[model samples]
Target: MKPRTLAGTCVPLCLLTAALNAAWAQDVPPGVGSESASRAGGNRLDRVELNSRQQSDTELRRKSQVAKQIYGRDELDKYGDTSVADVLKRLPGVNVAGGAPRMRGLGAGYTLILINGDPAPPGFQLDQLNPAQVERIEVTKGPTADKSAQAVAGAINIILKDAPRVSQRDLRLGLGYNVDRPTPSATFTLGEKLGPVSVSVPVSVFEWRSLNESVTERYAKGTDGQPSSITQQGEVLNWGHGFNTAPRISWRRNDDETLNFQGFAQKGQWNNRVRYNNSLPVGMPNPEDDADNKGSWRMLRGNLQYNNRFSDSQSIELKAGIQDARGTFNNLNLRSGLPRVHSVGDNQDRSLTQAGKYSQLLGEDHSLAVGWDLEWRKRDETRTTTLANGQNQLPDFDGEPFGARIERQAFFVQDEWEVSPQWSTYLGLRYERIATSSRGGSESVRNVSSVLTPLWHINYKLDPKGRDMIRASLTRSYKAPDLGALLSRYALNGKYPDSSVTNEELSPDRVGNPLLKPELATGLDIAYEKYMNGGGMFSVGLFHRRITNLIRNAVTLETPSFASAPRWVSRPVNFSRAQTSGLELELKGRANELMPALFDPKTALNLRGSVSFYHSRVDALEGPDNRLDGQQPWSGNLGLDYRFSSMPLLVGGNLNFTPGYTTRQTQGQWLDQSRSRSIDLFAQWIFNPKASMRLSVGNFAPLDGQSVTRLSAGDFTRTERSGRSWVGLGLELKL
Candidate 1:
């Protein structure tokens, strides 16, 4: 699909001029270490700087609130993790549902991500960022008036490193190995100060490979539930590669005004191959099928933003970005030395966004913020199916040439006020409008919707020393149905009747419904926090949500759309109500301080952990249920870190676990999944001031896992087992 005409062409011109003006405004003195730091001296300086920064936790504590957790550079470096997703997994109330991270067990769409307080560009992937580029990460569990009110799960803000005030450059190279192949990565960054302007450019490349295996079992209808068929066995291999580049420029016209510009570009490619062998029941009259499938995808995204600060507490920001992504998938099924089917698909997606925000301090105790944003998205897909020797071609599915266009607009206003010396409050309002149109061959559909939301938050300091605080909030949020799920013109059916078909499945025959409405939610939050000395903190929070118009899949049997066979049709229908509530406890501090008598201060040890207990009740099409579609009941993480005072070494490990939750399909198929656990360990050695190496073990135990799905109608069941594990050793260098 091709996006609308670019609107950012003129924006860069304005920012470029500001950059030039700021550069001419400043008159800086001679370089401090730009000329003196040779390779040897640079190494020494790098070590000292890293150590100094690791000891500072003031930034994290300073920016945190009662319902938020902030992880800074020191926390990020503790485990030698590579991706933002990896670090978030160890945080409280976070779960890796599938390809994306979910907060409080909410779906990916319900969880919002922002870059520097601005909505992230479409198609943005968290794993694309290298830890070196991030200055801090903030996880907000409740709605805040100054930001968008679309988060049903919560919000995550990623703050990138700013341009350095002085001239410096770094080059890093790393090599490692996993279960499948060698992994290699590299990064380079350059920062320079030109008079009154400062600029930084960073580029990185990384690659990884994986090996996985799975086994499946299927049983036919029987009185005793004895297995009538052992369905299939499968093996899979995957490899992925990614590259990224980001450049920033900041210029200060004076103490009262400043301008900054940042640009980002990233590309990634993934490849997967799968092999499966199927078994046939005696005299079943069906041929035994052995299948081989392979797929690959490549994605590209770019974004840019400009910010102008008029004074210490007032500023205006403008941002414009574009995303273009395309990929293809192909599958060929064979049986008895004959090609039974060949299917191929080519898909493309493109999006563009333009946004602006204005903020000013009304006085010492009050401030106001307003913003407007607009976005356009489009997707195009084409599929072809050839049966038996390429001589027979099945007619294109109902929506063969599928295409869609979606446009959305939002405006918001917020006010922050201090009602008293120890009390503060925030009030905000937001309006949103969305329009979408889709077409497939001769069929076309369009829809439009709008909404208004209001929110409020209050905070109180219960102690004069500011060591104890309480927070409460009541807000409104919503989750819009996925564009693809609402506009896709046709149904894509999976290959059935060959393996576990009789055992009942959530048939992949998905077709979009044009009448879907967004799910609306009213939420409440309350929390108390105790700030300890040495930047430590202990907190407990409670949250609740009441949601309506819940969207879920509804299946129908014997649909004419697919030759009188069962169809897993997805129609957005409203549900009565769903309620969710959860409790969170977080503790982070030095062990010596928490338990002075049990630990020695000389050990230099710290502890960090969180526990979350949550549950939800929803009226499903099948019946009453206690779980929302993607949410888990409970989750937790624990980690311990020790810094050796005698040497430049740091070692840490973490354990994250979640108990599996089960659910029922609209068609009466029940799915039960087993618990999941992940363990990671890391050891880092700062060999020189500029050089370091890390050894990491991820999913170290190779834990066995299983899941079962049962169909009451057919009295059939299917089970699958798999394992995940890997290890890596990496080296870092700076210049």
Candidate 2:
């Protein structure tokens, strides 16, 4: 179905569901819907009884010194989302593209991801993480001195569950269906408290299978000025299984001192099979006719923290951690005339970190904090490719090993001061330094960079009760080049050597530049918030960023040291300056509180909606379609939930949409993407408070297909792909 038709169908169904539920609620007896009603006397429970999570989330947001959005257990479990990416897509001003999360319409690397107040390690995949293991999610719109200043757009922090104060046990069993088969999943959580020690462990195992269909068309002109075209249709089968566990132990020596340990481990494997057929073969044969691929990855991390307080006004915290990760991949491809091509790759990474913070409360209005962070990381990688006869595909770099190391240090200080009953301010400064070195074959490079950033935030309360406020911030942030972008190594194209006979602009060789500099940004943000009774809020925000020394891949014809002939090579370079701005608006509350004329004054209905607009431009690019890469012009989300007054069930659904947009990649290249839409629905039945079951459907009315078009000077390529929706049913038990 078309995207617009699907959206039109799903939105009304959601509103109809809520309207029907509200009508039924109007028939409920007055005393039965009151808070003090007795269940034994056949009285229905009040809507307030189901608002614990909402109340807690709102209170936390209201009391925070920094402006942020918090999502608790309710948001995590409401849609029965299996992955963190799915959960984040419903948030305002956030989008998930290619399994990575983006904020304010900016692409990946603009948003910083953190786990438990620390940076997420390399090779972390948000889609592999289960929501059950998370306690809450925090999203900040700007940079802060206490953390890294790499957030040019924003930051997202995932807080893992901690040791509980009471002993508890819980189990979850689930089954999901996609294209061809049913997949199974299970999770178990245990928590215990003994004297001064507390322990908690949560483990989850899951499996998935999916099928995707794709069609590709390519058009190009030959030396004779004759246009040629080729069309290929293909199918891909993907299967995966994974397991993850999080464990925590806490020891409280006294009220003023504590020690804690947190550990996490994950392992997973995936397999893929592809089959392709040429419907119209008018040009040279394709290199990737049929393929088989398999890969495996694992990660382990452990952290220890200690905290102490010398007096009512003085406190300190120390943290140390170690992490190890590894991955391997193997691929086999069948060609038309040549022998089968086989490739293998392996990579390993290790890192260590230490951090500390000291805080003191001065006379009545000011609180000060100082902190430092230190980290070291190393990576080793090896890759080899050969024909069936054991002949090296690219003889120059085949079977070669590469290594890289990075060292980082940072120090920051911040103070929060209350100037009066209506005004509060935060002032901060941070200094950071990074050094990197890499070696491979006959190439070695080293680079060092340092930055000093200053940040300020001001909050003004419009009312003495502090229920309404305005917030403004000005900060400096930077995006540093990743290890791969800094390493001076050459990566050849698939099944092709660095020769002019087969090289093309669209299929270019890749190399890194060691001399690249970090991209720095100056930003401003303003927001207004109003808090209402019963966990309701209305907010609008605006943000702008001006970035210097923007990093973008530039494709050009060059003869590198590794290649004998002039070939098309794409390299990362700091080429231009850019700017981006956006406006965000969000409203969420009980339906009756938002629209008392339409809904009953005490109806058990809830509503949430948000819309955002984004605009950007690159100073070096041409006019019209010169927006930031992968950024949509606008996006929006609408969601609703209703509880039946006659039954022990709750139903909710959400609709998300992103309009299509085109991006001007370079002087001669342009990229276009199709609109994206998704509709998710869930129903939960509460069988007493200790047992429950949930039924969920994700992407209920999946679009028939999505298309992408890439246009370059005499060449054009377009790809369209389609996949099926998924449904899951799960049961939960608590003891």
Candidate 3:
């Protein structure tokens, strides 16, 4: 059967919502999932007991010293998101394109990701995490003195659940089905408390599958209108699976000292099968190609921290951690029934960090904090390809077997002062230095960089009740070139020696620049917020950023090699300057407080909406009209949730939209994308105090991302579309 069109996909989700409303209009029991012939309803409980935990959390975030937003467990249940990336997509001004989260139109490199206030290791995959293991999520748009100065756009901190005060066991079982495939997931958690010690172990396994199709038209143009053509079409099947386990232990030695240790490990794999057929113009030759590719990755991390409380308002913390990650990829290519070629690639990364912090109360209205951080890292990467044809072996690129060593040190101090009853401010400064060396074969390069950053934030309350406030901040941040980019490396998979074939003569993989500088940015932020009772808030914020020494890909040389002919050597370079500015508006409150206020006193209803608009200009290859790479023009998020007072049922849904934008590529090419959208619907039943069941239809109307790439030389256009959607059912039980 053919897949449904976009319009056809929306009908079922709309009908589902309509059915829910029709049921609410009928006289039915309150708690039962079954339906009688006439009208089935749930029985009312004895009393109207309301728990406002979620509301209270929102209030706390609004009053935080720094500008921030929070998402609690209630929001998690409503959206039924499986991964941190999915959850972050619902926040204000966050973009998750191609399965990675971006903030304020900036890509992942500019946004810092943290776990429990510590930086997540490079190459850490957020999708491997189970949402059930999180207590809350905090999103800060700018860096604070306490955190690193690497976040140019913002930061996201994921706080995991703390050890239970009492012994506890939790089990979650989940099953999902796409129209084309089935998905299975499960998680188990057990916590134990023994006197002064507490420990918890959690494990999870998840898998998913998807299908994609693409078409490309290549044209050879001349001064005349007539053009020669080549058409290619392809389909790919992708499947992935992951298994993760984390164990944490905490020790409390009286009330003055504490120690905590945590360890995490995960293994993930992805497999893809591609089939393609190409048709050539009269004189040109075309062939059918097929390939099977598989990639696997493993990660391990350990953290240890000790905290000591010297006095009422004086404390110190020491932390140490290590993380290691490895990945491997293998592919077998078959072209036009020729001899098969096998290719292999490997990557390894190891990192260690040590940090210490001390905090003291200077006086009645001032607090000071000082911290130091040190990090060491090493990386190794290699790739190899072999052909089955007799006496047809080719030498690898010169930059194979790449390696890098890096070291970073930083020191920061911050002071928080409450000068008056209505005014509070924070002042801080940080100095950071980094040194790196890269070796490819026998050649090597080294680099060193240092920067000093200063940050300030001030908050002014207009009234004694703290109902209205103005916040402003100024900060500086930097983004360093990654290890792989600085280390010269290349892998030529399809090309071979002494081959004149046009299509197979594609460019060889080449890394050029061994010496690259970090990008720098200066930014400003101002916001106004109005707070209402019961955790309601309306906010408007504006921000501006000026970036210098923008890093962009540049072609350094074009030459033929023993392995691949007609190859280009490319490197990242400091190209130009860019300026970006935007505005954001957000609203969060109870549904009953929004329009008609129609819900019962005991019922829980919540609504949240956020929208962001931005524009950026960059001076680069595209001339003065160029915009920042991968920057979206606009994005928005909306959500609604309701829990009935007379029943054990909960219903909610969310929508996320990002209008597409286009960008120019390195080789006189341009790419365009259509608007993207994500919708999710969920209904949960609280069977009892100890057990619950949830049914969720995620990506209910999943957007079909259509990307078109146009080349200038041959006037070629490549169009591709990929879609993702699924339905899931889960059961949770506590003991």
Candidate 4:
């Protein structure tokens, strides 16, 4: 079915289901068929039945006071995914773009990513982390006082594996196919308890390769008002290998206090080669181009946490962390009838963090928490560009080291109150200040910003059992400008020579603005959630955000201090105000319960799906297509899993779709992206409880091609690019 028609049908159906469930929930007695009741009777029962991963995950979501979703081991191991990005793409209202996860169709920087409740380090790649190292994933739809208030769309927290009470060991081996070669990957996890200490370590090694093809066409008016056109065909080959490990240790000091240490390390290298052939209409010789790029990065971080419970109603926790990361990159480009250009760069980053939180219980219905967070980070980088003859490309900036420092401090207080058995509320206030300083050559720039944010959330149980509920939140969130955007530096366009004065709008030189301010937002969210029997759930949510000081790059022709002549330069600026709103619907349940007439009542079949619609407008830009950059109009996914009754086998598949959309970046510039569709399938053969094999196909269908177009008064340029897919086979062991 068409995406529009499907969206129209699904929204109404989801709302209807929520209404029916709410009505039915009122008649059911409190705790009649709840998980707590099933485990009642002094914690002793005639028979014990362990909850499945799905059931446990559902319960966690149902119990959360705020709107959140929990994905446990079941999701991590569902398709034998080697990367966390692959696993995240199937989540509801979430999508992966440029190796980063976007929430609610918003682009990167909108979703705040956290590791073990702490903000992830800069330059961290989610695709490099193995899913086997994760214990669970938590997705919160709004900002909370305990966490950083940088989430303008939402937050996703990656909880690494923790020490286990019982000794455990597991290993996984996999082989993947992409392009014309086969790649191998492996992961191993070990956990043990010794005396008063518990330790767990998970390590993974993986390799990947892909080849993408593209065709570019450009049309522009020459000096004589005649249109000149050029077509270029290009190919890029990329390959990489990486390894990462997360080790955790817990030391239990009696029943009232505990200490923990967690360490994470990752190292990786990637190489790519590019070649392009130009086809001109006039048979004129075009610049022959060939480029090679290589890069490597490494990170090491460690954290220590301490917890103390002075009394039953009071507790305190303290944490300290340190991180060091380094990277190196080199690139070489060769052009016909031109000098060969070679560039190399090195980067190093270091950070220190300290945080503390204290909680107190007020009477029996209210819990209050106060916390403080402090962090300091510094980055040092050096780059040199030279010709094959050993002459510096840019004399003023060559071989010079530049650096930036960021310091952040925050204080927050929150209270959670159980007003009554049927209602709960959260009230929080936070004050955060960020200071940044950048130095390049003889110029130094410093910026400081502070914000005070207030957040409120409330939940109402439709029935006494809490099977059906309503959640609403009013929050103030902000997106801070990154170090790169705040740095005052000049980066010349590679397509044209540095000494050339002529430049095109599509290939403009880039520069940063040290005066850019953070984007602040006021958000409202409302959701209705209904939990059904047998690990089923249905939720419909609506969200709206009013944003001020939106940051966007503005292009203009100018001659700066570093430039000798006028050139097109794109610099970051605080654009006009913008607003966005969306509707999200999610439904997951057993086929027998959701559609009894279409399937057998006892069939072991499960179904899950989600659809989201979004709309946005920038007040500074004129219509017809003045939406937010990279935000699609609609997106959805459908998935199913079936277990064979007569065999030890399970099969599942998922289909994801996002329609094409256009964005009017400026009055004279436009960008368009093609529709995207992906299909993934997996089959598992269970030999026993401890061993299994899985065969999976990711992006089974041909990859979707994308196109981008830039328009001017009499000039236009368009580029079309193709994609690739992969397949894998994996063996999992529990010993």
Residues 1-735 of candidate 1 have per-residue lDDT tens digits of: 111112222233344346434532452222223444233343344345533453354334433433577778777766666677777788777876544778887778788788877666555668767877888888887656556666887888888879899886777666545544567887788899999899999888988776666676656532132434556666666777888877888888876556677777777666665566666552232222445555544455555666677687888877777777676677666665567777778777788888888999998888899998788988888777676656323364522778887798989898888877678888889888888788776678888888677888788889765577888888888887766776555444434422213212334455677667788889999988877665567888899999888777665543433344443444555645687889988887778766789986544677878889888877654454446766777888888876654344567888888787786645476667778788888777666556666766677564566687666655444445555555555666677
Selected candidate, larger TM-score, 2 vs 3? 2
- Writing each residue's lDDT as its tens digit, candidate 3 over 535-632 gives 67889999999998888876533453453335444568887888889999999776655544576444466788999998888766564326777887
Worst window of 10 by summed lDDT in candidate 1: 1-10
TM-score (all chains, Cα) for each model: 0.85, 0.93, 0.89, 0.91
Q: Give model 3's TM-score versus the native structure.
A: 0.89
What lDDT score goes with residue 652 in model 2? Answer: 95
Instruction: Flag clash pairs in model 3.
Output: 28-41, 29-41, 29-42, 30-41, 30-42, 30-43, 31-42
Ordered by lDDT, highest first, the candidates read 4, 2, 3, 1
CA lDDT, every model vs. true structure: 0.68, 0.82, 0.76, 0.84
Clashing pairs in 1: none
After superposition, candidate 1 runs with Cα above 4 Å error: 1-66, 220-228, 279-304, 309-314, 334-338, 391-394, 398-400, 497-508, 560-576, 621-625, 714-717
Candidate rank order under TM-score: 2, 4, 3, 1
The candidate scoring highest on TM-score is: 2
Please report how far candidate 3 places residue 64 from its true position, in Å: 1.7
Cα RMSD for candidates in order: 10.6, 4.5, 4.6, 9.0
Model 4 deviation from the true structure expressed as Cα RMSD, one decimal place: 9.0
